[model samples]
Target: MVHVSIHSGLLCSNAAVVRSFGLAPKYEWFDTPEPSGKNEVLVDVLAAGLHPRVRSQADGSHYTRPRALPLIPGIDGVGRMANGQLVYFVAPDTSLGTFAEKAVVDLRRSVPLPETVDPVRIAAAMNPAMSSWVALRRRVDFQPGQKILVLGATGNAGQMAVQIAKLLRASQVIGAGRDSDRLKALLALGADEIVSLADEPERVAKRLGEAASEVDIVLDYLWGQPAERAMLAILTQRSDRSRKLSWVQIGSIAGPTAAVPSVALRAANFHVLGSGQGSVSTANYVAELPALVDAIAADKLQVNAVPFPLSEVETVWHALSDIKERVVFVPTQ
Candidate 1:
């Protein structure tokens, strides 16, 4: 493998190093990674979000998990280059990730951010917001005036999906989630209507059909039973079954696989697509970053984020399930 020269004086730095899967990472000193490719540059990591993707990666459960051990567990973060330029970067799937004070980032995969932007907020909001932002912007022919239903809208990413759909000029945005309070709160974030998914199967289906029968797009974050139920409800209630319905699966918070029936595909003009790492081209993801960054930088979308020092990673990791706000690790004091 190609390696770049680094000053002998700056060999190591403290990081959240994971030596094995299914365990909380340890904060310890580790060798700083060097830029190994032509377009890569060494960056001083500022903040890395503790997203579900990172958790899965750390536990070796993510589909794109790294092959080796002693890995850092951050998929993306905000960092500063030697020239003092601030940027939001996606870390490559490697042992060296963004949970450390230093990381090697491919310049092509990063977006330069305004120096005035809050690093913690940027780190917290980007990954979650990108789920729906890229899904609607890149995954399908989403148009203004189209109606949308965001499954699992109470969660972080799903909450942003509600506002993003409105930002994209959807005529109607329906938010559905298990929490009644959170579903009601989505109204202020631009959801025209809300559906509670906490009800029994029959009632949940009835509510979904009533609120989102004519929606043109569905941004599904909860895939297993919720997705299957929503699909059947919308299909059965639609006045025009031939009307196009684009279901973009961004996450599977409920479960990985959905038991979709053959009739759901054959009965109507239903199109199910996914929008994540493999589905969207890296170039496409990078291309959409500027606009997304602008929105976050300008405070167009509400971001709920909490910051914790990198040294406290182990404590934070175990307590993450109880935290609703996005937890961002600050590598520097």
Candidate 2:
């Protein structure tokens, strides 16, 4: 089979540290060639997202993958194949990333984009949206009618989490965030109520405490003292004396360390677990790809996205680093 390739890909490959997050870019545009294997499909990268965590990986702070010099750092993107089908895939490592004109990843990792969906729109949902989908599906052990609290609710992953909870038909979806402006928007995105984090945690806790009986799960993105207090208050005041709380930690945008009370947790059957989308096996990815794709195609899931052309990657990376919202980079356009 004959294949075409492009060389221009966004890079953390530079020797100079990018000013945005105090990290050095290492990966250089070594190559952008097509795959020769049967199970691997070369995707023409149209768009990619600049995840802040990718910067962490560059700085050698991200808990996963040790920092290796000269690695392309991107976690997600959308593109098309030689067959002309639109597909989006989140290439895990800082290697073989999607910040390029083209990328060749395994066939299983790619999900088909619907004909009606713009490539940029589909690409926008690749990174943060998957966090919501994968976390709720694999970690939360969520069931219909289970009430859940989503921290950082106005955020990309938070918003997506709210939508995923409703997709599962969660009982009471509470969205928590510092932005009341963004909170109000959650009403249409399946959040039954929005809790602003701007106020004191105690105040927010008291407000939620009244309805605590209905909350069964907590999807925590903010991990500071506020989150700790909120969790504690909710756990202690829940009306359903037997309401078991399950918390899934997906992010730490607020802060890393938290004073999690072991004694407080023991009060009820509360369970806490960390989720980082542990290396996905190829077979399992194949299975999950279809449903995830169908959800995006059907518009069952919504994502916040900003589209940019490939050449603007340098400026765009800065934009991504500064803004606390979702962004998608379109390459072929």
Candidate 3:
């Protein structure tokens, strides 16, 4: 085995360190990371969001799992460099993550943040909002007047998708989910209609068909049975079968695989595509960050963030299910 040093030194920093998969990270001191390549800079990490993607990364369930153990577990965060410049950084799939007191950031994978901006809010909103933001901007030929339906619209990222679809100028936005309260809440977030998935399968299908039959695009976060049912419902109810419909799969909160009928593809001018890490190039993701950061800074998007000390990472990890707001870890706290 390759022996690694854990001794505290002048360059040591506190972080939530994961020694193995399928366990909570331990809060401890580790050597501070240094910039090892061109355009890389060390930043004092102020805030890192605990997103579902981060949870998956820690548990070794994410498709792009880290190669080795003894890793930090944040994918993106807001930090201040040695020169006092604040920035939002996206961590590569490596062991040195943003969950530490300090992190080495690639300048190309980060964007300068306005000094006046709230780091916690930026840290919370960027990763979740980027799911749909990058999808509409990068993956598809989304037009301004097109209509949209967000399939798991009550969740954090799903809620952001409703607002983002509106912000991007979609003519009508429909929010669909199992939570009635959250579905009702989406109306205020620019969802023209809401469908609850709590009813019988036929009823849920009928509701989706009525609300989103003619939608130009579907931002699907739930990709299993719900998605399969919604596809059939929308396809059957569509007045113009030949009208192009783009289905962008961004997450699989419901299940990993869908038993989509082959006839669904043959029925209309339908296109199903996935938008995530591998499908979107790093350059494309980075290029879209400036505008997204600006939107969050300008208060165009709603953000609810709750900060916790990084030292309590283990406790917080277990309590996440009870927390409704986005959880942000503050290293200094």
Candidate 4:
């Protein structure tokens, strides 16, 4: 059985959970009934992703408390609502796990999908798209001709940020990631330059400085010492031209926290900003999801999703937290 719900008890199905440490959670049967409330709808889960939040919550480090024991873990699902509409929904709570046959979800959190959109692709893209969209809107404010740098640029949200930057008229979009091949591959999506963050700390910092000197904005995902040092080195170097900076910090997949220099911020006149979902009001997000879908339909957006079968969820879940590509888990039976 598969899904997430706001209310308890929909016709029951077997769901999985992380029952103990170092071992995968096995499935157990549960009961569920049809949706009875005005704002709730039961959906047949078709696809979902093993997103970082899901993985962290499962691992007990997501900055939030773990769900109740015997938790059915899933936060995103593409499914059919009770009214028989094709939809995608984000369920951030673990009260109702998604690895079951079905669950009731709040109607407000669901987004109806286009007929042609693949369930797995939509499921994979939704969370990262929202994260990237919010990040771009709140963190990076680049003028049309401004140069922008995206660290961890190969990941799903990073690639989306690059596309969004170009869409919003960034003058130059430079993407730096772990893999040179992946960086090169992203150029088709409007990355003006691609560099590997593979060198030693000093070399990496110096290389980043030279690659995109006098950067106007940066969408950074890495949060460890290397990223922090590189950012400082790029901002602190002497130059006749003044470099006003804006940094939007979103994911810290690289490290828990960064060691930033307050002096560097002053020297560069940097405007460091945060781009997390915490700032986006739920109402506003609800209103914007339609527009976001339209933008995707119009080819004005792109997400680098790596599709895999639902059976490999644990494998994919672990990979999601790594500095890896965007993922889309399919019920590819």
Q: Note the Cα lDDT for every prediction shown.
A: 0.91, 0.68, 0.92, 0.70
Cα RMSD, each candidate: 3.1, 4.4, 2.8, 4.0
Off by over 4 Å in 2: 1-30, 33-38, 92-94, 279-286, 321-325
Cα TM-score of candidate 4? 0.85
- Writing each residue's lDDT as its tens digit, candidate 2 over 271-333 gives 788766564444554466678767777878876677766555566555565665566656642
- Please give, for residues 19-83, the per-residue lDDT of candidate 4 as tens digits: 65345545555565356678777777777766766666666566654646656667777888667
Best by TM-score: 3
Arranged by lDDT, best first: 3, 1, 4, 2
Q: List pairs with backbone clashes in candidate 1.
A: none
Highest lDDT model number: 3
Q: In model 3, which runs have C-alpha deviations exceeding 4 angstroms? A: 1-10
**What lDDT score goes with residue 240 in model 3?**
95
lDDT of 2 at 22: 53
Q: After superposition, how far is residue 70 of candidate 4 from its true place, in Å?
A: 1.9
Residue ranges of candidate 4 with Cα displaced over 4 Å: 1-10, 33-37, 139-143, 238-243, 306-326, 331-333
lDDT tens per residue, model 3, 110-221: 9999899999999999999999999999999999999999999999999999999999999999999988888899999999988899999989999999889999999999
Residues 1-333, candidate 1: write the lDDT tens digits.
122225555578888999989789999878778898999999889999999899888898988878699888898999999999999998876778899888899999999999999999999999999999999999989999999999999999999999999998999999999978788999999999998889798899889988899999999999998888889889988999999999999899889999887898999999999999999988999899899999999999999999999999999898987898999999873
Write down the TM-score for model 1. 0.96
